[model samples]
Target chain A: DTAVSQTPKYLVTQMGNDKSIKCEQNLGHDTMYWYKQDSKKFLKIMFSYNNKELIINETVPNRFSPKSPDKAHLNLHINSLELGDSAVYFCASSWTGATNEKLFFGSGTQLSVL
Target chain B: GESVGLHLPTLSVQEGDNSIINCAYSNSASDYFIWYKQESGKGPQFIIDIRSNMDKRQGQRVTVLLNKTVKHLSLQIAATQPGDSAVYFCAETYHLIYNQGGKLIFGQGTELSVKP
Candidate 1:
């Protein structure tokens, strides 16, 4: 089974449109996270949820919100997306929210806002 | 905010040759460091990791070296293959006091090209 999976492998939407990316993990992990990778290939952490609780919230704008229905699933929702929002979004999970733990990442969702 | 960065943006090596990717981090308090390999249309994959107390750790054909004194990290690949052609990133995180999770900061990443 794929350890971590995210839907909409490719997303092309209008600049002002709203979209949501779904993520699920079958690794039985307690923590899940959302990351954004820009065109320069720079990866930045957007949000993290531990046991369905918000744990980490970076400097991301309020337009981007993360929802965790459970420990095994985390979803990202963007309202009024902009051209700068075009990038690859990744979902990851770890056994625990430990610094030394290795993260299992989903293939990724490529978002293109035109 | 402190960040991790790579010295080279791209590195090219012949097949069967050894390749080394270097990274520099500014967070001196970082106790855990990891290396990740990301290929086309894929998320980053964990390659190897090293703790502050250890200077070197090896796994399969990859080895990770950590130098806390200089705040440097390096990944050494024994044999360069086409399969190994991907972007490599070094990430570091320190323990948050009284917290279980710490934020992992990734470097700019160095793209390794294995020339056939």
Candidate 2:
């Protein structure tokens, strides 16, 4: 069984398009996170939710929002996508609050904004 | 703001050789560090991690070394294999709210080409 899974393995859209990526984890984790890997392969945290509570919100624009319907699911919505938004977005989950807890990653959603 | 990234962008090593990937972090407050490996089309996978209190941590075939004075970290791979060819990223976590102030800042990443 896949521990973490994300929808739309690949997405190709033009600028100004609004889209959403869904993520789910069966690891029964309380913490979930979103990360983006750019062309430079620089992975940055976009947002994180712990048990449905918005925890870490990076300087990402307001156009991008994350919604967690429940602790098992966290979805990302991007409005007015821009060229710079092209990259692979990853969803991750951890078991506990320990700093050493490794995040189990999803296969990732490759969003390419034309 | 983004963390200052890597100085070396790519590295290649012969199979069975040891590989060392280096990173420099600007934040002195960062206490927790992790090494992540990302293959061509997959998410970054955790390799090993070390805390500020400990200078070194070793896993099955990977080792992470941290230097507080220089704010530097390195990931050493033992007996590199073709399967090990991927992009290696160094990430750090800092102190703050249990989860709010916490963020994993990733390096630009170094491409590891394990030649067979």
Q: Which candidate wins on TM-score? A: 1
Tens digits of lDDT, candidate 1, B1-116: 12335343888899999999999986999999999999999999999989899999999999998887788899999988999999998999988866547689998889899999
Report, for every candidate in turn, its global Cα lDDT versus the true structure: 0.91, 0.88
Scored by lDDT, the top model is 1
TM-score of chain A of 2: 0.97
CAPRI-wise, candidate 2 is medium
lDDT of 2 by residue, B23-101 (tens): 8877899889999899988888889989999999999889889999998999999999999999988888786765453
Tens-place lDDT per residue, model 2, A71-97, is 999999999999989999999998753
> Interface RMSD (C-alpha) of each candidate?
2.8, 2.9
In terms of DockQ, the best-performing candidate is: 1
TM-score of each: 0.95, 0.93
Off by over 4 Å in 2: B1-8, B98-101
Residue range with the least summed lDDT across 10 consecutive positions in model 2 chain B: B1-10
Off by over 4 Å in 1: B1-8
- What C-alpha lDDT does candidate 1 achieve relative to the native structure? 0.91
